[model samples]
Target: MTGPRSARSGFSLVELIVILALSTIVMGGLTSVLVRQQRFYRGTADLIETRSQIRQAAGIIPSDLRGVSTAGGDIIAISDTSMLFRATIGQALACAPVPLANRIDIPPLTLANKNTLASFSMTPGLGDTVFVYHDGATEAAGDDVWVPYGITGAPTMSSVSCGDLIGSADLTTPRYSFPLASPLRADVTPGTPLRFVRRTRYTLFTASDGAWYLGYCSPDCAGSTPQPIAGPFLSGAGGTAGVAFTFRKADGAITAIPDSVAEVSIVVRGRTRGIVDMGGYKNTQVGDSLRFSVAIRNRK
Candidate 1:
């Protein structure tokens, strides 16, 4: 039958074994490459996250500290890990003389469609403090200061027209009357400026996950819970601190007195939430840190 079909050609056993071995080697190399690439991408992501944490801490702290005044007692208290200060929330102009009563009036803070005669960053609320700029009668520079008054009750809307006092034609705009804890100085008259403030605190606090974070507490941190602003930062251990504050005087010397602090040095260290494989190391955590200083405003 066709000369015995010439030994039907096919791969021998040895040839099949060689082919399988080569395929296995190639697949192993490819898997190794894929593993390395995945590790690289993950490590890069962790590094970026760590840097973002540091930036978040940097953004809020400096801006808040820059608004504080050392000589004005804006820095209520300070320690290595925390600072309590008066944070300015809003500002407005007095439309009329402050009477010897427990109330003060500000011009229309918000007007519909019309130009606002007086504006506040936020509406004044109860328990907030207001600082009224006082121009002493004697014209002495030393005697001129900002007098503090506490708001006792909610602000009420009044139909009182501040157009005559503020020299604006918008008489229909209503005024906001804030009740005070006590009578203010009678000398606080028209054209005087006012600032609203709240006692705010910044501190490094431990979160529910057992990680440290930068926290912000307003009106004081004594009984109020702090809001986490940034971080799963490095834990404070072995002489390393997650956050530290150093107060410096004008001469650059460190000071413990809050009144003498002209500059504040802040150091924050951030850590990744998960372990990263990097540079042949496995299960390592990535970290980043930032150090900056802010000079207090209106430091006398």
Candidate 2:
């Protein structure tokens, strides 16, 4: 006779396997959804960062671009690396909250020589860059750097001196150079500039006749060189490929002189970093690019 039937409370191997398989399928679907959501968030974040960075630049460049002291080349002769940078100075009276009955005259400013040192920071090229072709080639060209000396109190203001040039890498160092002018993308309303503004601008021309390209630099000269300073400021790789500056005629309004780059543009190309296929991990990485442009103000 068989022993009393054992009251078993255990799942068979097949049942266990079935349960595990079903659980795994459900989990897998949940994981896929989660991963997709994460990716979406990441992409959105990246896009936001890109826009923010470019916009920051835009906020500053305009004032300085309109202030450019010189402008040459035909209407559309700029390229990726270089464009005309004009400088204008709003005198304390002109820029002051108080309205002036007479026109206020602002003096011109200058960036000091590279060797001198004191408080301000210095880039590699003394606020200058080698204007090159899109191929990253730099041939003999005009001085890519131009320091303007216009604006309020500048004429009588002390010239940029050894004391003005900071030796440290970071601009905020105790001896940081002045922010003489706002970058060419910011405020259009003319006003009094900060006392510690820069006095130089740089242009990089990657192409000759014309093509899309980026143009960025400190509103006024600061560091010893533009290379080290502007290089980092440029669009980081996997980000925008170029920042284009544009010069356009404002509607029917025409200046006896040609109206040029009242604004600059920021263009970018973003790329995908990476992600897993079915594993829900960072395995299969890919890349793509995104682009953006902004017409930064050149004055005020």
Candidate 3:
């Protein structure tokens, strides 16, 4: 009925097969490139994280250790991987002394103008230690010393006139009264300086996920959960410690006694979270190690 059917204007079966084969090959190549790109990005992320962890450890650990005084009984315990010490957390001047009542009052921690002389990194609490500087000059020349006392209970905030130690404008400023485990010495008078300390420990510990981390324990480490400050570092395996602590004397000799330690060397080794491609079927975990020495500022 239509004057010889026109020839179909469509690809032949062989042409269709060839085009499909080419498309499949192109798609396969693209898929390969995408996968490689994804792997590269992931590997980069892991490396960055590893480096960040190492930096965190380097920054935080040194600051804490530098404040410790090896000769002053601040170092409670030390080992290859851990160290416990009394960390100074704050400094204040005694505004008033109630030695017989086993109490001492200091200027308010927070002032309206923020001009208060007392500064605390942490709130004073039970089990904290206070180092009161005794003006041995009050008794005899060259007899000055610091006396340590333990805090026994919660501190109370009360409005107390600090007299000349605080400005008259801040006369109504509240103060904190801390109860001590024992009575202060009779010589401890108003305006005496005080050092607040807390027991702190730093250690290398394995987390639940089988990764190593730098752990921070406050007050004490025994039976207390450590806060992870850094790492997924290299495990102490194959003759390498995850975290290593070396104590040195002033003359650079190794020391076992805490009081003899004048410097501390810290070595932290970090590793990538997963294996990274090194090209040509080679994949390995990237790692870095950092070593730094910290001079104990209060060692003398």
Candidate 4:
């Protein structure tokens, strides 16, 4: 009655408690939404990267397998987590075809000689692979074949000093010649139909990092470190496994002959890695797998 009663200035205890509780609930919801979005982004990014790796492999693996140089256990050395095979390396032509010998003859066509230091791709090194094919129109009936040769040393080509041939003189071409692992079983003569020889290898190997990769090397894959053609085998529950190369005959039967492999089935498996454990996110994560069969054009 006399003076105004003291006005309430702050919230009551009960009111304060309710306000704090509501704020807590709101923040929790927002946090959950953010976390969910982040997780989704991570999973998507991982999947995309993995797919890119797979596509890169698709472009190379099949073609190399198809071009495998047939030989006795030389085309396909081992077909497990690791695979090894010979492939054509370059486009050096034989000016004159001669009988099977350990040496290859190169003409003075301004070719990029692998036997020269500037662009040496023909000089066979240890573990290098050499192959011969009859480009002749009338090859021996049974002579329709590809033979494999092992590389023994720094092969000598004609009288060239180095293995490079970028800007050499016309006369400097030197009629390149390089030795082979052994003498050829047949004759190779240059003409309307030229016999061809090549050097390269396709191999699948597991790196020190516990990942699988596809590698390619010149001459032979034996002594040289493989240049990865495909990489980072991400598979299994833990996301670390190698790709498998399955060779099949034209009739879908498994065979060992390099030329007999009519189809190659490749399978790649992988899973995304997690930054943090979200109730065992790996188990809940979707695994990735790529499988396809490639027909070998060079294989019968």
| Top-lDDT candidate index | 3
Instruction: Please say which candidate is ahead in TM-score: 1 or 2.
Output: 1
Candidate number of the best TM-score: 3
Tens digits of per-residue lDDT, candidate 4, 141-176, equal: 664655555556664556433233233554465655
Better of 2 and 4 by TM-score: 4
Which is the winner by TM-score between candidate 3 and candidate 4? 3
Q: Rate the local accuracy (lDDT) of all candidates.
A: 0.80, 0.35, 0.84, 0.57
Error of 4 at 268 (Å): 1.8
Q: C-alpha displacement of 178 in model 1, angstroms?
A: 2.3
Model 3, span 11-57: residue lDDT tens: 99999999999999999999999998988888888888999899999
Report lDDT (Cα) of residue 232, candidate 2: 18
The digit string of per-residue lDDT tens for model 2 on 1-300 reads 787887899999999999999999999999999988887677655545545544544555544554342243112234443443333322121121113211121212222234321211332123322111121124544433222322222122222222222323322222222222222222212322321123344353233323322334444323433332121123333333444333433342322332344334434332233343433435454333333333424221
Write the number of the candidate with greater lDDT, choosing between 2 and 4: 4
Candidate 3's error at 144, in angstroms?
2.2
TM-score of 4: 0.60
By summed lDDT, the worst window of 10 consecutive residues in model 1 runs over 161-170
The candidate, 1 or 2, that scores higher on lDDT is: 1
